[model samples]
Target: MTSEAEGRFHIVDVSSITSGSQRATLRTDDGVRIEAVYEPYTRGVTDTAVVLAHGFTGSADRPSVRRAAKALAEHAAVVTFSFRGHGRSGGRSTVGDREVLDLAAAVRWARERGHARVVTVGFSMGGSIVLRHAALERDTGGHTDAVAAISAPARWYYRGTPSMRRVHWVITHPMGRLVGRYGLGTRIDNRDWDPVPLSPVEAVPMIAPTPLLIVHGDRDPYFPVDHPRMLAAAGECELWLERGMGHAENAVGEELLGRLGDWLTRR
Candidate 1:
């Protein structure tokens, strides 16, 4: 599991009890500092590691993210990290564009921890990141064995829903950015994508042979069912349309988490 990237990880906490949970700081390839936590399997022994990526404004220490990680730990070890600009991480959020580097750093860290297989599970903005990371980092040491994207957008600049429209305002307006910073505790970069990075739909096809799962809620307000449908069609992957689910980490429940854990285990 060791690689050159392993040198970039600096463990800040080493108190490994039965949970094998520890805190560390990771340096992305681009040099952004990221906060991460590693939690070992809760029940049984397994070599697989699940790298959990949280949605926009969410961080490694978020309650929802922590719960999801704990639930998934029942199947295998889980690695959760705060994307740059969120939580205690350094750098501004480029939305989903450069976030791939953050995920790549986390994946590399998971591998360095001696995991035989690494599975990436993302929610919302994180979902988009995992798809793009799985595609773009395939050749790099950050490759993921499997991927699951939940409540992700198929395309960029999508304002189809009111929630998404508000999101656009939050990303594009100064006042919205102020609210995001003070109210949401999320610092967003003011620069627009000079050349828009790969969209989730476009990235999905490139993740072939690597198992992919598209999970979306039928009643999601940010992205409609068509988003997941587009991803499934492009990648020809497994699609799970949760009936009553709403969106992202907030909507995820124990049952769905268990199912996701099972999917990661079987993969």
Candidate 2:
């Protein structure tokens, strides 16, 4: 569905839009209307764009680090949008696999707008989504300057690791089991969503040279700290560990902000 505003462009009247915000909807290959926020730089620096995505059970305007969008727009154009069913975007979530299409849709949107250089910044589950989609972006002959993921899991098949299982039970204790029991086909809440056909770790190896940065907390409870290390070890990408940081919390830290800024500034 299109927005009510003129020309399908509506300004979001939220704090998230400090300077300004414009809306656009991309129709995915699966016929889903994916909603995206176009945060263009006001200084005519339109060549660069960052596609920001949120974690599972998170919103397009994820309160976690919405400011990052505003921060990035000052540098380049940024697009912070939702996966299907996660926010204003339409359709059901197919875990992170099918959601790759959502990321591709947003990338295409940026490219069409004359953004020759684009990067993706995903939070949590969104991290995994960005990783999966980055490969597709490369395969399609698109230009993705960089890809960064925060607190991402290298493997969602979290079945046997003792600590992994415990926390998994806590988060999904009330509802996750039910979703799993029904064999729910890789929905957003389903941890097994979009198992990557190959492990997420396997996907990591392909992210390098395209400029992949894996940002993880030293003490992320959801996924083991070693997971990111394993990811780093398996791939040629940069693994940036945030000391005393855990998962989404790192997004708001000064160190993270600085590192992110530096990374963006790099070629």
Candidate 3:
């Protein structure tokens, strides 16, 4: 499945790379096409694979997502994918709800490639999706070894920070959705989360027995330290609050990402 528009080429097939990595077009059960890239371990073939989920309005090719994927690839096989509505993928973003299906598809792809251990690592909106996905227990392999969420919100509809308020505005206003669709490459749903999806705090407890690492920054404006604290308490998991970290993928530098990769490998 290949297509071209205005001289640019698009390969929509599940293509294999010479280096053992696989780049594929994965379709979710809900009928969304996801752009996914899998990079096998550069060091050695390890049983563990880290599945990375990006933040809101972000694609797998974003510099921060790529940096984290590259860093984690040193420790284990890495799978990174763009959530629907974010990149070349189809469908509108249900914010964090339907995105879980996207993560589930990526996890299935990792398992299909024979990775025995799948560790999900997510940032911001991705972080919330990972939590809910783990709770839903929909991994194609029947189990996920570990989960790591960075700068995730515990509850929803929080507007304490200016950034979050702006985000809310972007999600609510028609002009904002227009800008999101064109400028950010994000096709977002304008409706509220009807029937209400499980909150991250509510989802955390169900991820127990499966190791969880909740990482946040004390200075994060998007979500205060209390968010991580609430998550830690619910899941009874380990928490790491960085001193001056800002938020999500951009705030997580190489050193911290290396440590996170190390943590995933150790488990």
Candidate 2: regions farther than 4 A off: 1-16, 42-44, 141-143, 159-196, 249-251
TM-score of each: 0.95, 0.80, 0.92
Tens digits of lDDT, candidate 1, 1-267: 112334778775435422457787899889999999899888777889999999999999899998999899889999999999899899999999999999999999999988979999999999999999999988888999999999999999999889988988888999999988898888999998989999999999999989999999999999999999999999759999999899999999999999999998898
Residues 17-130 of candidate 2 have per-residue lDDT tens digits of 555666676777778887777877856765778888777656556655467776666567788887886667777666567778788878877887778778888887788888
Total backbone clashes of model 3? Answer: 0
Best by lDDT: 1
Specify the poorest-scoring 10-residue window by lDDT in model 2. 180-189
Candidate with the greatest TM-score versus the true structure: 1
As a TM-score, model 3 comes out at 0.92
Model 1 regions more than 4 Å off:
1-6, 14-19
The sequence of per-residue lDDT tens digits that candidate 3 reaches over residues 51-152 is 999999999888888788888998999989999888878888988998988898888778877898899999999999899988887434534688999999
